[model samples]
Target: MKSNPSTDPPAEFLARMSALLPAAEFAAFLAAFDRPARVGLRVNTLKISVPDFISIAPFSLAPLGDWEPAGFLVTDDSRPGRHPYHDAGLYYLQEPSAMVAAALLAAAPGERVLDLAAAPGGKATHLLSRMAGPLPDAPLSALRRGLSSGGLLVANDVHGGRARLLADNLARWGAVNALVTQAEPAHLAASFGPVFDRVLIDAPCSGEGMLRRGEPVEWSAAIVAACARRQRGILAHAPQLARPGGRLLYSTCTFAPEENEAVIAAFLAGAPDFTVIEPARHAAFERGRPDWSAAPPAIADQLARAVRLWPHRFPGEGHFMALLGRDGEPGDEATRVAPFRRVPPSGEQWRLWRDFAEASLTVALPEERIHAHNDRLYLLPAAAVAVERLRIVRYGLLLGEMRPGRFQPAPDLALALRAGDATAALDLWPDDPQLAAYMSGAELLQAGADGWVLVAVAGFGLGWAKRAAGRLKNHYPRGWRRG
Candidate 1:
């Protein structure tokens, strides 16, 4: 597929839009497709504040809105993805409109949060950034020193490949109290019950929104219908995962009402506990079209609370979002779900990890939350539950593994730690020649005392290197090496 896409949209798609929109409005909507899409760089508050990032950013950036303090639009072609700051877990280059849903979910710090269908980790990263800290003296634990300290995020993608990718992105975000799992939505609902305080389902849909972005997706009316069916099936598991009085946000990056309001209407028909909550109005946000969904007057009236962002109406690609609020608060004894059965860190792997942390890290992890999954040792969030039957791609933070008598750290640990959190580190400027060499899997010649060294770009942790024989041998993952 060509990285640069053609400006013209599919003929059938244009025809559908003409029928859906008013004549004058349709003309403007069509014109939007011919224009460029707005790219977004959501700041990682877990790593740096928006003001701080702006002060140091090399790329041109403009704030999207005050509604989202961390959200910004990239104003120029300053390929940030290749920058050293990116490797430092600074920001995520997400689509502008796509950034809205997570903010709408308003996942506060110290809440038990879940990002269903989380992949490429965009929304999951946002939720975790806001979720870093204690889920209180409860099940969730996003523990850190000062940044809201306790809460936990459970991000799941059913596909194994996408789940792995999700794990990588969240790790790079320095998420400590999050779990990345590969499982069906129903399986998660069954395993955890309604334990989460906030649940976000960014459903897969027909790529009508990507028409302007030039995403290589073949769209058709049949596909829209298929997507709507799948969306409804997925939403069936939503209510079961959300705690009473908790919030659930359903979103899709599509212009189709079938996948937006219609799917929401269908979900409401089956689940009576949820009520659509109107979000705080923004000038760019338009109410959903009830008639478009062919829903009844009463149901349609509630669906009107849903919001739509058109490329023509908003400074972004198209998107649809609906926030549903579950009815009561969390005090039902029957609804309580079991937490991840704690297997206190033991055996050779546990001993090796303890040795490494004692020598390397300035802080100690919670022993009760440490889970030894097979040969690897994972530091799970406090809210994590046992999933012996489920397929887990990444279980919390993989501190490292034990090989015979020695412990080797994972790159995930480096990213999750601060430069100051480690006993020793190699801090370098973004433009340092050694930065390129480290990324290229080249060893750095350094004369220093070191066991496990945290490599930092500027002041943030990037990856790792080990100092031995008067030199820092590169321990950067081979797959991430770039020339």
Candidate 2:
């Protein structure tokens, strides 16, 4: 058979895959590689509803079935990431298959959750949105209360740069209760032993799924073996982070059985305290092939409960998922951190922020929640974990920094604020020329009083501006400025 020239999966790889999948199914899988890759975006319920987003969305979208309620398949050629809605944190552009892990983790409204390998924060943000419930309608105070009292989320990445990226994404998602940490898996496991109610490990894997992006996949045996070994090490440390009876979700974008079924089989054998849970059934989701697993019949039977999303069967690249439950009574909760002493802002710092908030914000943020570190001010969630040992990128929502006597709101604070939350807002239409100018960091004339102003598009806050002498000085971060 002539392999697809565009998306070259190694011929040897294809031959190996052929033995794993049935003859007809294997042919369909190859044909799927020739078709254009499908694109999807998941609505950020922390900011807007799926229905509300659909009403205002410029692109045409199709529902993504019952499995992913907030997910939509974009049929239009609109670049969603370039839109103002994206700047406002309304949605996330993610692959359809990548959305499954968090949904299957099924985190509840008040549970401590951890994304052990979180970076670039797709699953971490999704987990937070699920835990916080729907947004806009859910009052900010209630959201804060739920996050602090119910539980908090900790997103960790091994790489420092990616950990910063994860913090940025969570900040945009308005996850005030989230902690972004950079640490080795074993060290984190030691510090937070059996503390999380739910843990997700989207382990690093060989890029077999990269074929969907028209990227050539190197499926050599050596690469597959290396990925499997790394995945096993990650899995070894991940379960220790989940409390007794808590759930652990393992996922990867590769189709290799060594990285998928075999890893799970080995983990199950070593950790008899954990048992496999059947994946949520979906028409597009197929069960793991026990025949592909080299484990004994009993272990393979348990592995069959794992789910596989094949490109041929679904509108996404291939993925593998296994859900496991730690065995024990469900009451093994971790010790909650006592409330930390919040250092009040200095007299001048307090005056500047107070005057700004009173003038520009309609909502009253609690004084107790505000914490001052150096010249920067942070709005902490209801609770915070100890960060003495971890490389913490962001502790909570950064309200902004104080410059001399002046107070400046951060871009993160701007995205986190709702239109209604701000008293002095410059609301712009999606197509309004001023919106582009604002995003581009161009100064503009304003009729409002001289002070800080919220720049908004379609009632969603985009960033900040300072009005003086009838001119609005753009306060949009230079790093985020559009060319």
Candidate 3:
């Protein structure tokens, strides 16, 4: 069941943990790796409701824990990752413990949120869903209204490749009110000062949780020390992005006390304006050990307010989360730093995009906020903040390319829409042969008028196809095609 057989605990790691854990708890923690790691998935509530997804679930799925509302545990050997439902963005395969971070942050509607280290966007997607508030009904007309409620998520990662993957994941989640950015923490702080309502730092740390992945991780005191140093450095610039009374959450997958308590302790010591807020408690959650570090006497007790998810106790990989609140009440919106943004011209840019939307979509596009970068057109979120010179992977909903006299829609534009939004959609069951054909980049014969068509799997947008002369040509991205 494990990816590698070298998951046996390192002697030094065992020795260190033996000193840290009590006899019975240490035995359980050691035994947890011997069992197969359970697979977990969080439903994309933006696309489908949890109950509806549960009614049609293809596998043995159960609630993950009390930790996350949308989180579920997959008890079967079924590879949901390889299924069409996953491709259609019904649920995301995530470690159950990883879901605990955003749950603790608890972003609300209309909040300007930031994920300081978002990549492949697990937590960022969760944040966007939470910020979406409540949905209206099943065949979602409120999806646009939910996304447009002055809410926007700034999901950033330092790596360019990871940033692109993150954008792709958010797109599949049908997240239209998000901006994907590739920039370091310091640069972000400088560009947008004291603006975000909620900020999360899922800081890079020593991979003690790699044990759950069945990967043999070389553990040492030096490795934990290096990770702690990097965490402290990145966290130093985080407070500048938080507005007064805003919440900033710090989390790590490592069990290292140095990475967890020591980093937060150090940040609090340097910055007097922030204090730890006791996280919402769960039965599986354990209190953080402030005694594990040389924390100041004043905040040492408050550090216990942080939560720890140990594999011996929680039903997933190890993770640590601590929430902090900035001093003073929430301030006015004008205090935010605006990025350099220009109005896209009305002449050539409008023609192709308008033509595509008018012909294909049943709903109206937000034309006022649509901006262009070269030939590419993007729909910006309401009240968006512009970044002058950062490497932004995505501005908003990438409407697609406006080339010559025609417009080519992005894969994202299709995913962001419901089957009802499309003028023509081919809704097929999961076992349909044409569904596999479409995902594999093969064309199909269909009864339809010639133009753009949304190929759907069980009423969910899978990708786009163009129909001409009763034949459907696959427009699904070649890179995304399944073998």
Candidate 4:
């Protein structure tokens, strides 16, 4: 039975939306939207085991109805802000509906992938975690070859600040196989034409799904029309960047058809060889609404292939996704420039930093990967090369170690790692007292056995350090540290 329109919406919002969609349908949607869904998050497998993470979390971690095992429905509660696990990087705060796009792009280990707008690093981290463990030696070799030569993910964000934030998230998740680039869609397409195996186009859109978050958009015809134009602009070049037979997962957080089905229709109409992959592969997936489907030659069947998550139907923000792939394209087998450069370290500075780190922490770091750049010695992935040509915003520093002959990581590397580098330091766990001190601007002496203790807010790895006897000095930059 059709629901009554007036029964569902606030009198004011209904008045505005009445002219937009069918009054009855708009009312039903508002009725659903009013009761915003609970928060959800995906556990980072690269950091901690799911069971171990849940056990340590202060809040209840319920399994999500539709997402994978690592995904959970994080209940909306007063404790979200105060929770120590959050500070520790135990999990990423993401909506359940948003997980669909990333989970869809979970390629086999070593597949060359791209996250076109991978800022704030949520989906990028998820993809890397899936690529771990033993893989076909050839693909694994290709993947590592790319990592050594810097051929893995090119996580690009146009914004400078957000790009740094993305790097931090990826590093904390212990990613060591990615390259961070800052460029626009057109720029990327021109540089690496049709080379990626998988591409995630989580495009920007009007904040329709964020109505509960106080998005200030008015439900007007002009607003929707404008957003539709923008969505088309963002997705127009997506196919150009995707290799033939490769997957392009397009997604948006907004519920508007202009940004969802309409955008997909436009892309399909322009790109002839691409066909949409069905979402039916997922056990609980639901097809997109038919009434919103576009005209012929517009991939109408593909609309059915798309997945939709209405706020009322799912415990998350509204989202839509379509996985499209091109047929009959030759496989990618391109080689890349080597990623390593035999740059020597400044012996005196290297020794000074090493001495400080060894006496302060418990873990041991390899010395070969440590080198000097711009007179500042940095501990980087041994494979990283020729970063000077690119405008490098941040390359993580390798601080000293705990015991003599052993090295530890510095906490600040969270703000400075590429995806494929093996920057994971053993012995650091979220909630270690040293981590809290680091977050609060304190430099700490190693106090644990073997002098190895994890420094983190939750369970995420920030960096490693050595134990010392002097009063701990705070390294937290005044601008970045929160009280």
**Candidate closest to the true structure, highest TM-score:** 3
Error of model 3, residue 24, in angstroms: 1.8
Tens-place lDDT digits, model 4, residues 132-249 = 5333233221113223332256677888998888877765555555667677777777666666778888887766666654445555556667878877887887776677678888
Name the regions of candidate 3 deviating beyond 4 angstroms.
1-5, 141-147, 216-218, 332-340
Q: Which wins on TM-score, candidate 1 or candidate 4?
A: 1
Return the clash pairs for model 3, or none.
Answer: 339-386
Best by lDDT: 3
Candidate 4's C-alpha lDDT? 0.61
Q: Count the backbone clashes (under 3 Å) in each candidate.
A: 14, 0, 1, 40
Q: List per-prediction Cα lDDT, in the order shown.
A: 0.82, 0.82, 0.84, 0.61
After TM-score superposition, what is the CA distance of residue 216 in candidate 2 from its true location, in Å?
Answer: 4.9
**TM-score for all models, in order of appearance:** 0.94, 0.94, 0.96, 0.76
lDDT: worst 10-residue window of model 2: 139-148
